[model samples]
Target chain A: MSNEITTRMGDGERVLFSAEEIREDIRVGTAQAAERAGIPALSAEEQEKLFDIIADPSRIVSVQPGEEVIVSDDGCSMSFYGGQDGGGVGAPLSRMQAVLTYERACGADTTSLGHSDYSFKPVKPIINFEANDYYNTSMVTTAPFFYGAQPNLGLYFQPDGPCPNAAELMPMGKIDAARQAQEEAAGHLTRDLVFVGSRLADVGLEGLNLDTSGSAGDADFLAALNAVARLKEKVPDLPILMGASGEFIIGMHGEVEYDGQRLAGLYPQDQVKVIETAGADIAGVAINTTTTESLPWNLSRSVTFMKAASEASNIPVHANVGMGVCGIPMMEQPPIDSVTRVSKALVQIGKADGL
Target chain B: MNKEIFESAADAILRGDPEKAAEVARKGLGEGIDPLTLISDGFVPGINKVGDMFECGQLFLPELVKAANAMQRATDIVNAAIPEGEGQTRGRIIIGTVEGDVHDIGKTIVVSLMKANGFEVMDLGRDVSTDRFVEAAEQFNADIIGTSALLTTTMEGQRRLEYKLKETGLKKRFKTMVGGAPITQRWAKRIGADAFAENASEAVKQAKALLET
Candidate 1:
C-alpha cells in the first residue's frame, strides 16, 4: 500500500503530490526558499500549526444554520507561501469546486450559496468574459441542488481610472461589463443575485488613502455605487450585493475628518445612508482580512463594523469570510480557530440570526 | 515668497494635476522663490493632506496615485534646481512585490507613503524574483530592502530572499522589512526580519525606525 496525496482544482486542474515531493518540501522547506527569495518565513511552530489545522476538519468552527457564508475563489492563500502553485495539500481547488465544498460543509443549499470571483488583473474584456463563463458554468453545476437557494454571483473590481482610449479593455468600464455578464448568465441561472466589491490590489476602500486632489476617494465610492445602480437598472429586480470593506464602511466610527474639516461620519446611520443611496439590495461586509490575517491593523474591529452595518442597512447585511486565505493558520492558533472566529462573528457580532 | 505660489503648488497637487503642479513649480522658480521651500511649503503639505484624508477613508487609490504623481512632478522640477547632494532625502530604499504575487495595490501605497515621508524608493513592481532584489539593492546601495507579499504562497519569495541574503553574507549589510495582508509581526520576527508593518503608514514608521537604528 502506498500513501498518496491528490487534490483537484478548477474545472480541470489536477495536482498530484508524491510522497517524495512532500518529503523534499519538508527537507528543503519554505523557510530556506523564502530566505533565498527575500520573503518572510513562518517559524517552525507556525509551519506545524498550518498543517495541523488543514489536516483536521474537526478543528474548523462550524457555521450555524441560516447564517450567510460567502466563499471566495481567491488563490491568495492556496499558494501557502510557495508550496508550489496550487500543488500543496493546502492548495485551493478551483473556484467552483471550492465554493461547492464550502457550501456542503456549512450545510447551505446550493441555491442559497454566495459565489465570489477575483479578477486578479481586471482587464475589461477578459474579466467580463470570465465572469460570464463563471456564471453560466455555475448555473449548470448548481441547478440540481439549487432549490430554495438565493444564488449569487459577484465580481471584485475597481473602476478603471480615466482612460483616453474609450475602447481600451480596462476596469473603468466594469459596469458595462456587469450588464453583459448578467445577460450572459440570463437563461442560465435562475433566482440569482449579483455582488460587486473593491478590486484594488491591497486593501479595500478603507486602506485607500484619500486623494486630496479632487476627492478621488469619494469619486471611486460614488462610481461604485452608481455602477451598482446601473447594473440594477439593467438587470431589473436582480438583487445587488454591495461589498463594503469593514474598515471603511463600518470601521469609521464617530466623526471622521481630515485636517479638522467635517467628512463622512463613521456612524452606522451614516454608512447606511451611502448604501441606500447606492440602491443596493444587500450589504456584504468583508471579514476576509480580519478573520484570516489582520493586514489593515484594525481588522479586529470587523465584527463591530458588521454589527454597525447590519443595524443601519434596511436591506439584508451579511459578512463574508475567506476560509482558505485566512484559515491557513500562520500564528500559534489552529486553522479551525480562524473558522470558529468567523462563524462566531457572523452569528454573534454580525447579528446574522437565523432567517 | 508670494505665499500664493506655495498655495498654488499645494492646490495643484491636491487637484492631482501633475502638469499644473509642474507649472506651479516653474512659476515659483521664475519668481526667484526657493525651490526646496516650494516643495516644503507646497507639494509636501498637499500630498501629506491627501495621505491624511486617505487614511481616514476620505480618499481612494486613483486619487492618491494622482496626487502622488502630481507631487512627483513638482518635486522633479524643484530637485533639478538644487545642486547635487542638496536634495534632502531620508535614505534610498528598494521595494517590490514578491514573486508569484501580482497584487501591488499595497506596494504602490507603500511607495507613495515612503516618498511622502522623505525616502528615495526604487519600486521594482510586482512578481519580482529574489535575485532581482539583491541585485537592485547592491546596484543602488539602498539602505533598506522592503518586500511585500499579498499572497501567502508568494510570501516564500520573501523568505527565499532572506536566505539568499544570508547565504551571500549581505544580511547584515541591509535591513529587511516584510508586509502584506497575510504577514504579521510574529511572522516577521520568526523570519528574522528587521521590521513588520501592517499598512503603508506603519511601513514608513518602521522603515524610518529601522534606518535610525
Candidate 2:
C-alpha cells in the first residue's frame, strides 16, 4: 500500500503527507495539548488508531457500521433565515416545516426549532404567550422519535437591546462605564435566558442549545453560566447543550470572573468544566480553525483539544465541526474529505459523544 | 511639544489604557501641544507598534482591540480640539457586516484598525442592508466602502451591495471591498469588488491602497 495520505490545508488546498509524518504530528500534538491543559492524554493505542483513521486512503471516511454516535446541529434553517430579500432563493420552508424536514428527510436525531432572531436578547420580546404557539405547533408536527429543541444564542452585550452602551462607553475613555455596561448587559441576558428557557421547557421542548456562548467575552460567558444554573433549578430534567464561539474566550471585559475562575483565555478543557458546573448536560466544544495551517495540522490540533476536553468534562462532549472550525476549512461548502476524517477522529480518538 | 508628555501618551496606548490615553491627550493639549501633533507624534506611533506586534503574533485579538480602544480615545480628544475645517484624516471609509449576518467582530476589528490608521470610518454595524451601505457611503462621502459576510448564505448581500452601487450609477465613484471567513480574492473579483482582505491589518493596507488608486 502507498504510504502517502491525501489531505487538505486550512484554505482547502489539496496536499499530500506521509503516514509516518501525520502520525508523529498527531502523537506529539495530542500529548502537548493534554499536558498544557493538565488533562489526561489519549493512550498510545488511541493515538495509533487516530493516525490510522486519518491516513485512510479514501477521500472520505466514516465509522464502521455500528460505531455511529449521536449527532446534533446548531443554527439550522440558515437559508430560511437569510430569506429571499437576503439572497435566499426558491420558496423557503417555514420554521415548523424545516424542523420536520430535518427529522424525516435529513435523519437528524434531534432538531432545533429557532426563530430568525436566534438570540435570547431579541427573542425575549416575542417570548410572551405568543412564542409558545410556535413551539407548541412544532411539537405537534415533528415525529416522536426526533427530539424537539429550541436554541438561545448567547451573544455579547452590545449590538442588542436592554444593555447599556458599552461600545460608546469604551471609546470615551470611560473604562468604568464600559465595565458597568457589560455587567448590566450580562444581568439582562441572564434574566432573559431564564425567562425564555423556562418558557420553552414549559412547552415540552426536549432540548435547549445555548449556542455560541461567550461570543462577547468573559461577561457574555458569565451570563450563560448564570442562566444555565437558573434554568436547571427550574427544569431539572431538560437537556441543555452549551456550545462555545471559539477555542479561547476573548477577554473583552478583561477582569470578568466566573465561579472563582477567571473567564478570559479559558480553553476547551477548562471551559468545559465551567459548563458542567453551571449544570449543562452537554458541553459542545469548538476549536477555531487556523486558515493558514494544513488539514493535518488543524485536525491534529482540534483532536488534541477535543480529547482533552472530553477527558476533562463529566458531561457528554460534542465537537463543533463546520466551516472555519474543528479542522473544517473556511469555505462555503467544506469538502467531505476533511469533514469525515475530522468527525471520525473526534469520535474514535477524541472520544466525543456527539458532533 | 513636551517630549515627556508624548511618551506618556504613547505609553498609555501601549498599555491599552483608554482613560490614561485620554487624560494624556487632554494634558498635552493644555500644555500647548498642537492637537494634530499630539496624535501624529504621540498616539499614532503607539498604535502602529501594537499593529506590528499583532501581525507578528506577539499579541492576540483582545490586546489589539483594547489598544485600538485606547488609541481611539486619545484620537477623539485630539480631534475635538482641532478646528472643524482643519481636522484632516487620511481618507473616509464606510464599513459594515452585510445584511442577514450578525457577525461583526471581524468588521469591528477592521473598523478599529482603519480608525487607528487615520481613516475617518463610519461603522454601520452588523446586519446592514444594501441600501444603507450606499446611503451611508454617499452621506459620509466615503472614499471606500467595505463589507464583511461571515456566512455563505449572507455573502450574496455583498453582491447585492455591488449591484446596488452599479444600479445607482455610483459604482465608479467609490471603491468597494469585501471580507470575512468565507471571503477570498477570487470571490471579491467575482463580486466586482476592488479589494479583499484576510484580516484587520490587511484591511487597513487594502483601504489605503484603494484610496491612493
Candidate 3:
C-alpha cells in the first residue's frame, strides 16, 4: 500500500494528499493569495517547512508538548451567552467567573469581557449620555474582578450594527440613501466606542477587542477604523485589538474609502495596514473556511494570507483561529487535531504573534 | 428597439441600481413589452450573472445583496403587471434562522435569491421555534422549509425542526433544507434534512431540486 498522508476536510471528511501534492498546494496557494492581496508571498524554503509541519504523521501537532504562545479571544461572553440552553440565558457575571476560572486553570495571555449584545449599537441607547446607566454599571461592576487575573482584561464590541440599519434603505430602492446612512452611522459608532472605551479604561480595562469588524462590509470596516482612531485619541493608553470578520471586505456601500484605499475587496494584508494607521495595538486577521475544501487547502490558504498579513503589519498580528476561520473547523468546540496543526502552522509558518 | 430596452434593464441590475432597474421595468411596460419577458429575458439574466460572479469570488456580499435588491425592484414592477392568472411562482418556500441563532444575513440572502428565482418565499425571521416552522409551512402551503443556524450550539435546532415535522406527520409534505456556517451535508443527513445548501445560490438550486422530486 502507498504511504499517503491523510487529513480531515473542513467538513470532517478524511482525505489523503501526497507529500509532493501538499507542498505544491502550499506554494501555489501562498503565491496566489500574496499576488491577490498585493503582499509578499512565502519563500520556497518557508513553503517546504510549512508542508513538513502539516504533513506530520501524528494526529495532532504543536510547537512542543508544553510550549505556548500569546492567546486572546473575541466574543468571550459567548460561552455564558449560549449557556446550558444555548439561548443566551446565562448571567454576565457567570461569564466573568468562567474567565477567572479559565485563567486559573489554563492561562491565557488576554481575556475579554463583553455583553451578549456584543455590538455598540444596542449599548448606545442604553448608555444614552449617562441618562440610562444600566449597562455601563454592569461593566463597571465586572471590571474590578479581573484586575489581578493572569490574563489581561479588555472590553469587546462589534461595529456590525450600522450595516444592517443602512441595508434597510436599500430595499426601498434608495442606494445613495443607504450609503449616506452608513457614513452617518459610522460617525455615531465612533462616538459610542470612544464613550464606552474611555469609561471602561477608567475601570482598569487593559484592552478593547473590536470583534468581527467588517461583517456588514466596507461601511462596517470604516466604522471600526474610525472608532480605533478616536479611541486612541480619547484613551491613549488603551490597547485596541481589531479582528476582521473575513479575509476580504465586502463592498456594501461599494464607495466608502479609508486612507485613500478602497475598503471594499481589501484582503488581510492590506486590511492590517489601515488598522495600524488607525493605531490599533493588534491586528486580528481572519480567513474564511470553505467547508467543501480539504483541510490542507484551507490551512494552506489561511496560512498564506496570514503570513502576508503578518509581514505587512507593524502591530501584533493575532490570527483568528476558531469557528470557520484560519483553517479551524466551523464547529463550536473545534477538534484539537486541526486546531493544534493550524496554531502550529500559523505561529511557525505564518509568523503570527498570537491566536 | 426592444433589444436596447432589454440590455438597459440588464445593465441596471448589473450596476445594482434599484431605482434605475424599476424605472426600466416601468418604461418597458409602457413600451408594450411583455412583463414576463422583462423578467425572464432581462433581469433574470443579470441576476444569474451576479450569482456566477459571486461563486467565482469576483463579487462580494454587498454587491450580491444590492443586485438582489435591484432584481427585486424590477421583478416587483413586472410581476404586478403580469396578466391576472399568469403570475405563477415556481414554488413556495418558508425560511428562518433556527432557535437561539440570531444570524439573519445568510437566510436573508437565501430569501432574496429564492424570490428572484420566482419562488414565493415567506421569511419567518430569526430565533424561530421548530413548531413555528411546521406551522408556517402548513399555513403558506410551502413546498420547502429552510432553516439556518450560524452557531454550532444552535445546529441542534435544525435537527429538532426535522424531528418536529416527522412527529407532526408533516415530514413528507414539505422538503427541509438546513444551511449556515457550521452546517454540512453530513450534519444535514444526520439531522434528516432533505438538503443542505452551502450558500444562497446553492440554496435556490436545492429548493428547485427538492420541488422537482
User: Estimated TM-score per prediction?
Assistant: 0.56, 0.74, 0.78
| Candidate lDDT (C-alpha), each | 0.50, 0.76, 0.74
DockQ value for model 2: 0.13
Candidate 3 lDDT, tens digit per residue, B115-143? 65767788887789988988899999999
Expressed between 0 and 1, the share of native interface contacts present in candidate 2 is 0.06
lDDT of 2 at B172: 99
Q: Per-residue alpha-carbon lDDT of model 2 for A280-309, expressed as tens digits?
A: 988888876766566766777788789888
Off by over 4 Å in 3: A13-47, A64-69, A73-105, A116-188, B1-12, B17-45, B52-66, B69-89
lDDT accuracy of residue A47 in candidate 3: 78
Per-residue lDDT over A1-355 for candidate 1, one digit per residue giving the tens place of the 0 to 100 score: 1344432111112235444543334324334323322323434554343233222234344545765544322232223222433332454465455445545544443322122222222223343444443455355443222111112111221222222211111112233443333333321221112222222111111111110101112222333444555545654444444444334421111122322322232333344446556566555554324221221111223434445556666776545454322112333222444446445544553464221
Candidate 2 docking classification: incorrect
Q: Which stretches of candidate 1 lie over 4 Å from their true place?
A: A1-106, A109-117, A120-227, A249-279, A287-300, A323-342, A353-355, B1-50, B60-89
lDDT of 2 at A137: 54
Which of 2 and 3 is the better model by TM-score? Answer: 3
DockQ of each: 0.08, 0.13, 0.23
Question: What 10-residue stretch in candidate 2 chain A is worst by lDDT?
Answer: A145-154
Which has the better DockQ: candidate 1, or candidate 3? Answer: 3
Cand. 2 TM to true fold: 0.74
What TM-score does chain B of candidate 2 reach?
Answer: 0.77
Best-first order by TM-score? 3, 2, 1
